[model samples]
Target chain A: MPAAPVIAIVGATGAVGVELLGSLARRNFPLSQLRLLASKRSAGREMRFRGGTLIVEELTENSFDGVDIALFSAGATISRRFAPIAAAAGARVVDNSSAFRMDPAVPLVVPEVNADTMQGDEAIIANPNCVAAIAGVALAPLHRAFPIRRLQMATYQAASGAGAEAMQELRDGTAAELRGEAFEPKVMPHPYAFNIFSHNADIDPQTGYNGEESKVIAELRRIFDLPQLPVGVTCIRVPILRAHGMAISIEFDQVVDPQVARDLLSDAPGLRLVDDWAGNHFPMPSEATGQEDVLVGRIRTDLGDPSGRTLTLFVVGDQLLKGAAQNAVQIAESLLPAH
Target chain B: MPAAPVIAIVGATGAVGVELLGSLARRNFPLSQLRLLASKRSAGREMRFRGGTLIVEELTENSFDGVDIALFSAGATISRRFAPIAAAAGARVVDNSSAFRMDPAVPLVVPEVNADTMQGDEAIIANPNCVAAIAGVALAPLHRAFPIRRLQMATYQAASGAGAEAMQELRDGTAAELRGEAFEPKVMPHPYAFNIFSHNADIDPQTGYNGEESKVIAELRRIFDLPQLPVGVTCIRVPILRAHGMAISIEFDQVVDPQVARDLLSDAPGLRLVDDWAGNHFPMPSEATGQEDVLVGRIRTDLGDPSGRTLTLFVVGDQLLKGAAQNAVQIAESLLPAH
Candidate 1:
């Protein structure tokens, strides 16, 4: 094998960061040495790796001193603070936050869709939102067949995308409800055990877009470079812990056949077509949680518009894997020229 | 009020049936005499209504004797075999299953939306599918505003819609997962606790439509009498036990406005506006489980479809209440030519 890449994982103790490590090990990414970085609160902890244990270190500007590649899964604030430092330190950085996504200089990429556009000398590649990342994995093939004119999407997001605390909150809240025990809400603002919450969190009140919804729209447009592309989206937080599902309605410039969409997605990169309505086996969260590929199903030509130019389907993917971490690693592996 | 219309509740032992009795009492639907009927398996059971014990008798040809109005929340098969018997016995039957929803002679009623359509001459009234029924509460006002040309809907249904056993399976399956006990699937064909199953029951293997999706499409057309009105729907069974949520996208012939749609629904009977993203106060299953009105939110113009003729929104309602029993009872309350 070729010499391994020296990779550093920021926020290694967080949900997506942990998955980033697992995905690398599972795919056997050629890694020379793994540097795990977290906040002071989680520094000095030990976590599992390929076949050994790695010690977590506190993250600081100087921490990127010798790293070859830095993957950031921390929150936007942390990424905003450290990503530039890591990039300035001569490391290629793949950011899994909205921080640098809309920046004209930083390339937002899903390798299979925009790999070539990612390899610019600026060295910071932004990851799209999990919903867009997963949707793009399936839609890219169709867009190849018939360039999309407009897209309508409603997402059912998992809690893990928020952070480890959100994941714990869902697991513990649900566990508490089952035991008929009182569970104080700390991870999320509301009770989230069996209930599905609106994904529009912290409304801007002025623009009528919440933090989550705004991120989805902005990141999606930036990633696809369809600034004028008509898009309508409503983000919902469902009770699932790790996978996100989306009901996507697409309107293409030309007529669409359900079989054609299914055929394209059947072997699309990073996508699994599980659309056998005969077996009741369309993609679902419970089945897609630990999976790496985005699952697409309920494939059909939507006659709702009788003009019949739309194809509506459902998509499920592990929010932490393909949505965030794995995509980041995959991008680093393919390092687009625009990054 | 003139003496409460003599009322009867059939299949009063099921989940919807139980909710029907409570709703009738809570809504103070006029009731001079109450008769309860159930299958032989549940015969002689007792239920409390209006501070008195009501005996459930075995449903027979004479079950509706002396009944002025009969509300049926039984399964479709039971309704198909018995609703006509009750109507023949001089009682007006309002059925909450799919049995008569598409029958040309029966008026599928959502009193708040299409009360004027009920002439009471059919003797047997049908309640639309829970999601379809609740959707009308929103669509009727919008249809009046722009006239619906097409509908694209994705349903997140609760287990309670299947029956009491399905509800138990969800609770039991979840509890088992919590207790570290391996659970055997019985009531549900698959795992139910944290999982969202397909809205379909038993795929036909030939025609891909599930029983639930087919009913939603057929019932909507019959209720709207626009047999050609384009409808594309996907029914998903979620872990929610009693409420159903739909992410609906609609196309209209006239220009559509999101704020205008919100205002129309705010005062529309059987519909509640829950669009406050600032408060994170949108429609939800746990909140809508016992509520009568369908909760609507995330109201937005379909920016992706720039012709300004499309709008999208999210709606939730109690499958057992507004979607089923309560709708049936409301129909019986207003269907009689003379109350």
Candidate 2:
């Protein structure tokens, strides 16, 4: 790989894409050249980069001709069609889509959890689901301390998980509600203004689990290398603009003290311990937005189990950053040589 | 008690107070007179009930002199000061505050779960917390079937739980956020617009459980008549306006089937089964608002436990109705002779 790689950002106009630009610039990614690529609709859009404006070009098979690293944040269909082509064209692809996450060949990675999974030779690296990535970052240290026997998660996800259009829908629908006007949801399936609903992803009839929940469950299992780890998840979309929050109850094989767990999380990379019991302040999505670390708090022993083998906690992280763009960028950084 | 009781509504200008008026009217509650009462500031305010406007009176020792039944939706301090005075004046009080819920003498009643606990002799009947009330209505039938071993709950509570001012704060804060203006939070400690936070209730320093969580746990135990029942609760305040949603994982003594639980809940009173697993539609605050019945859905086995004794479900209910006002009204209705 070149000392300074030529980087291409797919879905350059989407929410995660915008965050990718910011994260790359803030982290000072060593990129000799940066190409912004999107659909035909956003082709000529100019996005601010390191110190100047970069014109977005329409994504095509030839978009990765000279690119050494391609970061993809488009939907599954776009990534499915273009990621392989970009990889075949000699660019290392780090995808934020769910297309190749469960594939055995593609390493689904959370840099803080299992960065070593991605060797320099892999053509493509898959980023875990936003919820799974956040949970992985917060739970990895605890899982290492006490093997997680089971996990129960309920997610309060934001509009951005559905993409930039859904974020716009949340804003516009909320504005319309404030104005006392009727809002017919255009991007999201439900009226998202000051409302909460089950994730819009298709539900598996037999299991009654939505696609997003399934992705989080499977991705976390894969990331933790616990193939048989049992996980139950409920994914809900709240009216939040960008960040995601999750309430998690974990059962471990052995007793785990809350203070020890807090200490482990405090020292864990990519995690910020926000457990302030006296202040009644815990992880909140509003404070976690645009922040890199996953904020974790409300760490206490599960009240239902007197055996002291279970704990409950809450976590919040910016979906656009740690969940999507920052995770993919970290994977790309792992592929590069020492700075 | 009088044949046609004079009903007084304390805190008649609040959110739950408004719902109490609507519920009483919709249910065609028998009353010789309806008295609206609020603080001194709102004494002259008018509220429409049963076809005419009733002038709000300042709640005092004399407000309940001729009243036979009083519904209190005021805060705990107001309930603490006025509830006993009302009872002393020959009015039976059904309080919607947390003041007397844990009092051994005050029967904490969810009509569908434990109406018999209040034998029409108790001077004051206590309404369960909003989250606990919703859960009680949905879980009572299932607990009867399999005998619940433990319960784990995560609540997506609405702003109305904090009262009318908090609801207003949510709306104005959201509007300010949409307008790109600064919002100074008055009712809530956090910026409630597009944000989810741990329930603003005071946290127990030793346990890390907030007051809302503690109430739900304690109230559920009392309502279920299981003094030693194990319940783990996490209460979160979401951006929703009126209704509350809960994700519950239940462990039973015996293995239970999803169909059996569905059948039990479908036939249960004060519950509407909305389990449309194939449609990816479940209970949501938007649909549950103003609805009397708790919407229960997403019934499935807990994937984490292979013992087949655990099930997971979701429930949504209007906090002002099923969670508060309607429950108080139902208790008052039970006090009447069979008609």
Stretches of candidate 2 off by over 4 Å are: none
Model 2 chain B poorest ten-residue lDDT run: B273-282
B297: Cα error in model 2, Å: 0.9
- Top DockQ: which candidate number? 2
Cα deviation in Å at residue B106, candidate 2? 1.8
Please give, for residues B147-167, the per-residue lDDT of candidate 1 as tens digits.
888888888888888899998
Each model's RMSD to truth, in Å? 2.4, 1.4
**lDDT of model 2 at position B291:** 91
Candidate 2 docking class: high
Grade the docking of candidate 1. Answer: medium
Each candidate's DockQ: 0.60, 0.81
Span of ten consecutive residues with least summed lDDT in model 1 chain B: B200-209
Q: After the best TM-score superposition of candidate 1, give how far the Cα of residue B170 lies from its true spot, in angstroms.
A: 0.9
lDDT at A221 for candidate 2? 91
In angstroms, how far off is A280's CA in candidate 2? Answer: 1.8
